[model samples]
Target: RGLFPSFFREAQRREVLLEDLLYVSSAFERIAEATEEMLAEMEDSLRKPVDPEEFRHFWLALAEDLEREL
Candidate 1:
């Protein structure tokens, strides 16, 4: 029947959307974890003595790496 075909199509569309959403959610989780780890490392570095120029370069490189991962 026509109604049955439409129902199946809509269901398929919803399934695809759900899959996309899950993939995005996983990506966000990964990004968040990576960001948290980076922040913790920065915090630890702050607790110790670090050269300003060295820290600046390290921070910039970390930012670039984070941007690529995201």
Candidate 2:
């Protein structure tokens, strides 16, 4: 996951001990799972036709919130 790569690099750059880094890296799995679920939901939504303007707004808001969450 992008978060892991960036976080791992940051921890290493700061000379964090491997044990500490390992603990921090443990959170990556949950983050990755959440990301995958969100993507899959978006893909499923795209499989069906929806009102263009409404769907656009829905996806745009979702994207904005996800970006903030990430």
Best by TM-score: 1
Model 2: per-residue Cα lDDT over 6-63, one tens digit each: 9989988777677677877878877899999999999998797878899899999999
lDDT of each: 0.97, 0.88
Residue-level lDDT for 55 in candidate 2? 81
Candidate 1 local distance difference test against the native:
0.97
- Candidate 1 lDDT by residue in tens digits, 2-69: 99999999999999999999999999999999999999999997799878999899999999999999
Query: What TM-score, over all chains together, does every model reach?
Result: 0.69, 0.41
Q: Which pairs of residues collide in candidate 1?
A: none
Q: Which residue pairs does candidate 2 place in steric collision? A: none
User: Which ten residues in a row are the worst by lDDT in model 2?
Assistant: 15-24
